[model samples]
Target chain A: MRATVIHAPFDVRLEELPDPRIEGPGDAVVKVVASCICGSDLWPYRGDPPVKQPRPIGHEFVGIVQEVGFDVRTVKPGDFVVAPFVVSDGTCPHCLAGYQTACQNLVGYGQGKADGGQGEYVKLPYADGTLVATPEVPDDALVPSLLTLSDVMGTGWHAARSARVKAGDTVVVVGDGAVGLCGVLAASRMGAERVVALSRHEPRQKLAKEFGATDIISERGDAAKDAVLELTKGVGADAVLECVGTAQSMTTAFDVARPGATVGFVGVPHGVEVPISTMFRNNIGLAGGAAPCRAYLPALMADVLSGAIDPGKVFDSELPLADVAEGYAAMHERRAIKVLLRP
Target chain B: MRATVIHAPFDVRLEELPDPRIEGPGDAVVKVVASCICGSDLWPYRGDPPVKQPRPIGHEFVGIVQEVGFDVRTVKPGDFVVAPFVVSDGTCPHCLAGYQTACQNLVGYGQGKADGGQGEYVKLPYADGTLVATPEVPDDALVPSLLTLSDVMGTGWHAARSARVKAGDTVVVVGDGAVGLCGVLAASRMGAERVVALSRHEPRQKLAKEFGATDIISERGDAAKDAVLELTKGVGADAVLECVGTAQSMTTAFDVARPGATVGFVGVPHGVEVPISTMFRNNIGLAGGAAPCRAYLPALMADVLSGAIDPGKVFDSELPLADVAEGYAAMHERRAIKVLLRP
Candidate 1:
């Protein structure tokens, strides 16, 4: 099997690796049907110091079970499924409570013993808990959308769900990346009356609109807040979905939210400290984290199979698994909102 | 008129002052019938610099209106009412949305201009909005209970309401002060099946039990959290109310809350910065701010009038306004759960 590995900064390469096999009683070996690069993956590709040594990369994937361990019962060989970015025991208290990200018995792929999902064959732990089977093998065209269920789309959905986006809500999405675009879609699906996307890029703005943005604000920070206030007739938005984790983005989310409104943030936060005084004065509610993608996958996958939504429009580029390097470069250079890889 | 003044640290005195008179069209002068010192008022009494000198003190009061400005319509002369700690216009967007604390035209009393509540007479701003008229003036025995409505009890209610404490939910309160006792009461009223009160003091623990604490923990920090985990069979409580503003209190709130639980905090926060990464990973929801007490006033007053609840039991000590210094000392020295001041 060929796998993508980031050996150093900007050094992504396709390296041949031995095929994976089921090791634990609860594990299964999956033949990767499709996989994709993620925003966080760029951390190492862009030289984040913590990711030091060469390692198989990519956490999001849609695959078919080729073999299952003796103890596996929920899924079987030939079953097409979506694997969330994190593997969690379905029976844990946190998992049962719909917070799989905090499940005590949790594991991450592309780590140590687990085979990276970008490869042709990946070993999946807690297969019954991490994988959600589709109604049947989805069509090739539907694969892209189903694969997003592994991370980005569900990540975006978590932001909206956390903010409690309700019918007739005026929601603000404060980013234009794939996650933010998906927020527009999620807010729309949640019955929000108006969805505003903040973006300065022309192409991204168009994509945001396509994903269900009722309005687009090209301005950033204070100006973006002003636009939101004006759009809501001086009454700030009902919910602010922060898909960008920067300090400025979080600030904008608070600034544009009406008093008593919630600001749901799902981006990997950096240098963000919630101004306690501000949150206190406004009765603002803040929720969202590394999305419990496994918790949201079942519903989102159903939406995809029934053709109720089109989250796959985010994938603007595609390549065979061998050209994984090009996929990384395209995403890093902002040439594609998302890159789909065929294994 | 006599008013309680904190001229300096340990310099509380009963000072003679002119009787308050309406100064604005939205103001009304009230002859204070009952007043009390809040836990926060002790900050300056103990030498916290932000609370400055030579000012009339106390923001919690229940009074009888003496006169109303020409523009005041909702409240009139001769009405017995309760004033929220913060004054807000009843017509603002935030006020209309039940977030009076964040109203655009907000005003705070007890500092300057607005005559302090712990006085013979207080010049109330936004009289129509800030003051809630009871069905009728009550007997002396109920005065202390109604006075609690002005701040501490309302603050506790805010914590429970913010945490969304519901039927059969297990609620943990972090702080055993007046507000924490009030939280136990509020949670019980909100239908919580069990309430855990954290307090080391025997008197406060007794008060907590009276207010409906199903359990009590004398431990603080990690041990307290361990007690809570042990109580809940390691699943954590459904809601955790943080009534202590210390960093440790906030941390304990998170440490003892279930993954999907909310931490409703009402204590004046100091040095409490929520670790966003931890909150995110646990999908922990953080809500609560200055208790929108005015928004809660009507419902609470209705309950108070109907005898459905009595929040006044938190006032355990009584002192004449002239002995305000001793009142502050009693609270500071942990000799009293709360001090009631008579003007």
Candidate 2:
């Protein structure tokens, strides 16, 4: 088997490794059919938080169950399944409450116990709790969309849900990454009358529009806030989805929210300082965090299969698993919105 | 007219002032029947944010409408009304959305346009928007409860509402002041099965228990968090009301919130730094701010009038209007939970 490993900054390689095998009663081996590079992977790749040692690296993927332990009842070999970024016991109090990301017995993909997702095969625990199977393996064309349920699509949906986006809301989506684009789609699908996307790049803006962004602001910082306020006729957005976790993006998200509106942020924060005074004075709320993707997989998977949404468009570049390094490079350089890899 | 004025820290005086009169089409002059010294008033009294000059203070009061501009419709002369801490037009988008605190034409009491509430008479704009009148004058005993509706009760209700307290939830309140005590009542009224109060003061603990705190944890800081976690079987409280705005209180509020739980904070934040990373990793959400008390006035008012709640017990000390300085001193020295004043 071969897996993606990060040796140091800007150094991701597909290296040969021993094949994975189910090691626990709740474990299963998945033959990776599809995976992709994520923006977070860039955090270490760019040395923002430099890698300390060589380790397996991906956490999103969809594949066929190649083998399953005796205790795995929900899925079996030959079943197509989507694995959320993290594995949970599903029976823990948090998981039972629909927050699998905070599961008491949680396991992260590529973190020793579970094989890295961007690999030929992944042996992971808590199979029954983490993997969601499609009703039936559908046409190959639906793979990309289903693949997204592993993280980005569900994460985007979580942002919209967290912001409490409702049918007549004017929603502002900050960030034009794959997740933000999906957020635009999620808000629109949730019946938001107006979905605003803030993006400076032409390609991302076009994609954002395609994802149902009713308006696009190419400005950054205060100017972007002004544009959103202008678009909403000085009322600001009813709900704001902050998909990029940076100080600037968070600030913009809070600034453009209307009084009493909530900013649902999903981006992993880095140097982000929440404006407590501003939020209090404006009666604004901040919600959303690491999305519980597993909790959303079933419904989102149904939406993908039913063609109610087509989030696969977020992947503008595709590569063979062997060209994984190029995929990482393309994403790091902003040459690709998201790169899909075929195993 | 005589009003409470702050000349400097530890220097509150009751000085003779000119009688107030309706100054705008929407203005109303109310003859205050009862007013209270708030926790926030102590902010300036203690010089955390030093008083710059002699200025009328106090923003919580219930009064009889003495005079109204021709355009004032909802309230008229002789009508008993409860005034929210701030004045709003009640017609702006934010106001119409039920966030009167953020009204486009918001006017705070003691700020030029609206006369300070502790004064014998208050001339305020946007009468219809800021005043909620009772059906008719009732027994004087109801005066205390009704007066609380002006701020603390409504603000406490806002915290529970903001925290999204639901039936059967285990709610934790982090402050034991008037507002936090009210929060205990609010959560219990909302059907929270377990209402926990983190209080060390014996007087407040008794008041809190009377207000429906099912459990009392007198520990502070880390011990408090451990107590709450232990009580919830390490799952944390389903909802947390952050009634005190200090950094330590805010930190504790986040620490004891269960995954997927919301921390509804209403205390005016002071030097509070939000733990964004912890929130993101645990899926704990931070919501609620200054609290749009006006929006909640109607329902809570109805509850008070019906004897469904008794928040006025929070006023542990009473003083005549002429003793305003002593009232401020008592509150500043923590000799009073809240001080009620009679004109």
Candidate 3:
């Protein structure tokens, strides 16, 4: 099978790798129908020193089960399914509490005996607990939407939920990436009365509105904070979704929240140190981590299936599996909001 | 009027100062009935650079309103009241949302036209919002309990509430000082099934149990963490109340929380920086600030008036106004859990 592999920084290749097998009794071999490059993938692709061993790339996918190990019970061959980026036993205390990402026996994809979700065929462990099967094969048009349930959409939901978004809330989304756009959708769907999307890019700003942004701020840093504060009548927003994990973005999220408001962040954090005293004095509530995507898959899948949401619109480009390198380039060059790959 | 003054580090003196009077439409002059030396007083009294002007000390007290500016409507002369350490306008959005401490027009006690609560008379700003009136004059025996309602007890309640303590939660109070003992009481009152108090002080450990600590751990730092983990079947506590503002206490609070648990902290933070990425990944929630004591005042007052709780036990020593310096010394030397002063 050909899969996306990173040999080093800025070097992505579609390499011929040995096909995956169901070695674990709870594993299933999936024939991936669609996969998408993620923002995190760009971390290694854009000049971070790579590991000595080639790394498998991508974790978001929608696929059909080609085969399952003898003990796999919940899902079987010929079923269309979506696997959350992280696999959990779904029986541990944390998983039972709907924080599957923190499950004691959690296994992240693209590692261990499993191949990347971007591959033509991949082995998914804990098949019974990790895979969510659709009632039947989804319409080809809904494949992109289903693929998002694997991570980004679930993450967006996590951000909104963590912030405790309620009806009549004024929400602020701090980034305009695909995840940020999805946050706008999630906040709106969660009944936020007003959602302010921050963006300087005209294209993303337009898409942001389509995804339920009631307002848009083009400035960055202090100026952006001023705009949000002004729009909120100086009270600040009731909920803030931090989709970018930089210190600047985190600070803005904290600054733009009402005294008792919460900032729900799902961005992969890096080098962010929060001054606890400031948060304490301001009465700001900070909640969110890696989204327990598995916990939310059931509900979000229903929304996608019923056409209540169209998060797939964020996929602005699509390419064949062999052209996977170009897919990364398109996102890296800002030529695509998100790239979908057909295997 | 006599008041405790900090002329220099370790130089607490009972000084003769001009009596306070109502100076604004929103002001009231309160004749203090009882005031307690707080842990925070030691900050300025122990080696902090002194100002040219002597600083009036203390922010915790129960008092009687002696006079009010014409516009002060909530309480009149002869009303016994408890003032939150911070005064707020009460009409701001933050105050309406139960975060009075972060009110847009926040005026901390002891500043502006007001003197500290420790003085014989204090000119309080935002009188209606800052002072909570008791049904009548509280009994002399209840003076210490009522005084605690002004700050420490209210702060402990804030910590328990911020952590979202539920009926079945196992709570850990991470300090054994007066405030920490109060937190154990708050958590237990909030219905935590098991309350753990961490302290190495034998006397404090005894008081912690009387205040509702089901378990007491005499270990500090890592050893304390191991004990808490062992007690919780290695899952850590569901809610942790951080009553000490030091880095060591703050870190211990985080270390003993279960995944998806919350840490409620109320001590005035001195040098605490939180590792956001680690908190993000762990799904730990951090909440609580300067207590918003005014918000919790009414409910807590009812609990005290009905004799349902007795936080006055923390005031193990008492001093006359002239011995104010000795009161500070007793607390600094740990010879008293809390020192009550009468002017």
Candidate 4:
């Protein structure tokens, strides 16, 4: 079996590795069908977060169950399933509260012994609680869309929920990546009357419009805020989804939100100072974090299966698993909305 | 008429000022029976905030309406009333939504007006919306407690409401000033099972206990969080009311709150940095701001009138109007819980 590893800054290698097997009572071994790159993965790849070891790279995957442990009841051999990037025991208080990402037994797939979908075979614990069985083995034509539900699509959905984007809400989604593009779709699905996507890429903006972005602002700082104010009659957006985790993007989200609105930040923040004085006086709510992807995969998968939403449109390029390094470079250079790797 | 003027940092003087008259169709003139110094007044007094001119200092007051404008229909001359520190028109969209502090027609008494309660008389704008009339003049003993319904007591109640303290919640209040003590009373009134007061002062802690604080944490930082977590079976407090707006207090509030709980902050935040990263991941909802004093005064007045709560005990000192300077210094040095200055 071959797996991608980030050995150092800007370095990715396709290394051969041994296959996995069912290791625990609640565990199941699955053969990866498809996997993809993520923005979060870039943190380590760019050396912003130092790599402690040659780390197994990919998290998102849709696969077929190869084997199951004695206690695995819901999924079995040959079943096509969407395995969440992070495995969680679904019975904890936080999990019951629908915050599975914060579950006590949470394990990030492919980060450690949790070897991820970048490999041909991976062991998933708490299979009954972590993996969702599809109606059938989805055809190759639908693989890209189904694979996105593993992380990005559901993450975007989580961002929309955090901001409380309801019907008739004027929404502003900040970021042009796959997650941000998917957020536009999620906001539209949740009935936002208008969605303004802030993106500089024409290709990404085109997809954003298709996902229900009513407007676009390529400007930064004051210009972007002025444009939003003009569109909202000086009231600003009812909800702002901050999909890019940077000091500037967070500030833009708050500046473009109306007093008493919410800024849902799904981006992993780095070098950011959250201005409390502004948040307090403005009376806005801040909500969002690492998404509980497992919690949302069910409903999102249903939408994909029913042909109501095509979140897979975010994957603009696809490559064979053997050339995963090219996929990483393309994404790092901002050449792809998302890069899909067929395992 | 004479009013107290903040001439400079640490300088206050009683100077002759012209008597105020009704200036608008929705205004009235009131003969101030009582006016008190507030913690917020110190911001301009100490010059932390800009004080361009000698400004009138008091905002909290109870008085008798001496004159009414043509459109002032809620109360007439000779009516005993509690004047909300914030004068709201009660007819704007925000006012209708119960956020009268953000009213389109808002006027901050004393702070914004040339004539204020520090003088013998003050002009009240949006009088019908800002003044809550009593059926009759109460005994002199109830004056202090009733006056509090105009701001401090009502503001603390606003904090408790924003935190959503329920019947069975274990609430932690940060701050030991009049507002924090009043929050203990408000939390009890809202049916919280347990209330913890974070204070080191013996007198304020005693008052907090009287106001239904089941526990007191004299310690701060990690020790305080440990105490709260131990009390809550290592889960932290169900709700936290942040009545002190410093960065340390906000950090403490977030540290001591249970997952998915809310923190209501009523104190004017000063140099506060909210770690929104922690807040988002923990599912902590931060809600609060300038208390819509007009919105909560009615309920607090009813509670006071019915003997359901007594907020007057928070006043540890009282002084004649001429001695307000000393009262302000005492509160600034933490030597007094709150002071009532009688004019």
Best by DockQ: 2
Order of quality (lDDT)? 2, 1, 3, 4
lDDT of 2 at A78: 93
Using TM-score, give the best candidate's number.
Answer: 2
lDDT by residue (A1-343, candidate 1, tens digit) is: 7888778989888898887877889998888899999998887888865657888888899988999999898899999989999888888988988889888888877787577878888897888888899878889889999999999999999999999899999999998888999999999999999999999989889988888899999998789988988998898999999998989999999999998999998998888988777888788999888899888888899899898888999998999998999899999999888999997
Candidate 3, DockQ to 2 decimals?
0.73
Selected candidate, larger DockQ, 1 vs 4: 1
Report fnat for all candidates as fractions from 0 to 1. 0.83, 0.91, 0.72, 0.36
Q: Compared with the true structure, what per-residue lDDT tens digits does model 3 show for residues A75-129?
A: 8899999989887887777787787888788876667756787889888778887
DockQ numbers for every candidate?
0.80, 0.91, 0.73, 0.45
lDDT of 2 by residue, A1-343 (tens): 9999999998999999899987889999999899998888889889878788999999999999999999999999999999999999999999999999999999987888998989899999999999999989878999999988888999999999999999999999999999999999999999999999999899989988888998999999999988988888899999999999999999999999999999999999999999999999998889999999999998898899999999999999999999999999999999999999998
How would you encode candidate 1's per-residue C-alpha lDDT over B144-250 as one tens digit per residue?
88888888889999999989899999999999998999999999999999999999999889989988999999998899989999999999999999999889999
Please give, as one word, the docking class of candidate 2. Answer: high
Residues B120-144, candidate 3, lDDT per residue (tens digit)? 8888788987899999998899888
Q: Report the TM-score for the A-chain of model 4.
A: 0.98
Residue-wise lDDT of candidate 4 within B199-303, one digit each (tens)?
998988899999999999999999999999888877778889999899899999999987667788988988888777787677676777778778887778887
Interface RMSD of each: 1.0, 0.7, 1.2, 2.1
**Candidate 3, position A69, lDDT:** 89
Among all windows of ten consecutive residues in candidate 2 chain B, which has the lowest summed lDDT?
Answer: B284-293
Candidate 3 residues lying further than 4 Å off, grouped into runs, are B49-52
